[model samples]
Target: MSSIYIHIPFCKQACHYCDFHFSTSMGKKDAMIQALIRELELRKDEFRDEVVDCIYFGGGTPSVLETEEITLLIQTVYTHYQVTTDPEITLEANPDDLSEAKIEALHASPINRLSIGVQSFFEEDLKLMNRAHNATEALQCIMLSRKRFQNISIDLIYGIPEMSTARWIQNIEQALALDVPHISAYALTVEPKTALEKFIKKGIIPPVEDEVAQAHHAILVERLEAEGYHNYEFSNFGKPGAFSQNNTAYWEGKSYIGIGPGAHSYDGKRRAWNVSNNPRYIKAISQDMLPQDVEELTLTDQYNEYVMTRLRTQKGVSLSEVQTLFGDKMHRYLLQQAQSHIEAHFLFQEADRLYVTKKGKFLSDGIAADLFMLNLFQHPFDQNSNQS
Candidate 1:
């Protein structure tokens, strides 16, 4: 099955820690929406014959779109793709944008899921993050949203230096108390060039200490588990049957089409990403061209992609599927390299499936890089090629 991702690159305000490609300007919203519909038609044949399982409206913030704009995009997808009867159409929204009227529009739309960007429930944390919404609205919208959308997933950012273990526990407790179907929690990382990094450099904000982040991460695991949330993916926790279908499809290497600036698309063997600049994207697509960079995956590239994504999830890497897709020699390499992690109690093997254990989850990125193919350095994803 295939999936679709639409990037709405407009927001009311920019969060300090966010490095995503989005603009604070709404002047281009009308043009962007119209261009998006045209681009969807342009890339209609990308997915070919696979049935579309999920359509994700991600952002700057999708909730910023008017109801008519949202409806028109949904119509565009249905017109061009082989969408399933009950596709999981999810919209990424901020608490401040979810008004009563917008909620009513969402309730009546084809969109069936809501993924709210409730980074924190505390006013202090929200202010530190420079979030547009205050703590009151964050809590208020969830209560209001539940009446309309059944499949709701909210994001929580943990390990902010200002967020204590007790405060983190309260955040988890509040989410559980709300009883949303799914939750995705992440440890904050300071990416280069973000305001958070500059603030730390200037001593305006304290840098995130690795040890402190690790401690908070431990608390997250313990508390979410206690609250009956399964750590499905490394950063995601959900009750049974509530895992995000869109992201799960990505982790499983399903082909998907991404429409909009900074969006990426993968069709098993090749991947492409649009130009990140809004004006450049609009100009290019206005000329009937999809402004994207493309790469065809080499065998080694494919293997590394699998290692990076699969190891982060609870399912681990499936040896049977590996052999089926990559042939015997690749399978042999995996079995050989896996013995070390298994002996170290980081990864466990069961009936040909290799999965990361609880202790191994934190160091997953390092482990996956270590297992990369030694040969075939020409591939864009070759870890060693990019590393010193």
Candidate 2:
């Protein structure tokens, strides 16, 4: 099965820590949606050999779009692509946009999952992040969503400056109380050029402490695991049968078509992405011209990606699969690179699979980097190409 990610690159307000490609003024929302439909039609052959099982509406805030507009996109996908009998269609919404009426409308739409951006459920944290939603709106949205949508996920950021251990724990507790089946929690990093980065440079806010982040991460993993949520991926926790299909498909390196400004597409060997600028994308698509750049993944690029993505999952890296897919020389090189980490008790090898130990999971990025082959450096993902 394949997946589709539709990027809605518009937000009502910019979050201080966000460095995503989006415009605050949504004057071109309608034209952008139509452009997305055109792109979908034009790229209908993307996953032609597979059936689509997931369609994720990710964004600057997908909830910024009206339900009818979202439905139009879904209908476009159905019209142009071969989809599964029961597809997991998700929308990444913001608390401020998911009012009671909005929730009801979404319930009627084809969207079966709600991935809400409830970064934190505290007033101070909300204001600190410069989020559009208040603490009340955050709580209200999740509570309301719990009643209508069973497959719900919330995004929470830890490691914010001045976010006390007590407050972080409370945020976890509040999410648990809301009965969300999936939680995508991440450490707050000061992305370069973001408002938060500038704030720290100007001494307007304190920098994030790594030790504090590690501590918060421990709490998150422990609490969520105790509550029957599996830490399936480093930054993702899900209760039984609630893993994100869209994200899992991505982690497994399955083909997916991404539409909208700054969206990306991947086949087994090639990667392509649309223009990040909304006007450029809309103008190009209107004239039946493609607004995208393409890249071919070398064998080494594929191996590094495999190592990076697999190290984050519970399954870790598979030597047997590596042997078959990347051949024995690369597999041997990986094992050689990983030997030092294994000796340090950071990773464990069983039969043909290698997995990060609990102690090493917190530092998985470093461990994954350690396993990379020579000259296998990768370009950071283009910002707008992330998620929904």
* lDDT of every predicted structure (CA atoms): 0.88, 0.90
Clashes of each: 0, 1
Candidate 2 Cα lDDT to native: 0.90
Candidate 1 local lDDT, residue 72 = 97
Best candidate, TM-score = 2
Ten-residue region with minimum lDDT total, candidate 2: 379-388
Pairs in clash, predicted candidate 2? 58-388
Residue 136 of candidate 2: its Cα lDDT? Answer: 93
What TM-score, computed on C-alpha atoms, does each candidate reach?
A: 0.95, 0.96
lDDT of 1 at 165: 83
Which runs in model 2 stand beyond 4 Å of their true positions? Answer: 376-388
After superposition on all CA atoms, what RMSD does each candidate show versus the true structure? 3.6, 4.9
The weakest ten consecutive residues by lDDT in model 1 span 379-388
User: Among these predicted structures, which one has the highest lDDT?
Assistant: 2
Model 2, range 279-342, lDDT digits (tens) per residue? 9999999999989999998777787788998999987899988877777667778898899999
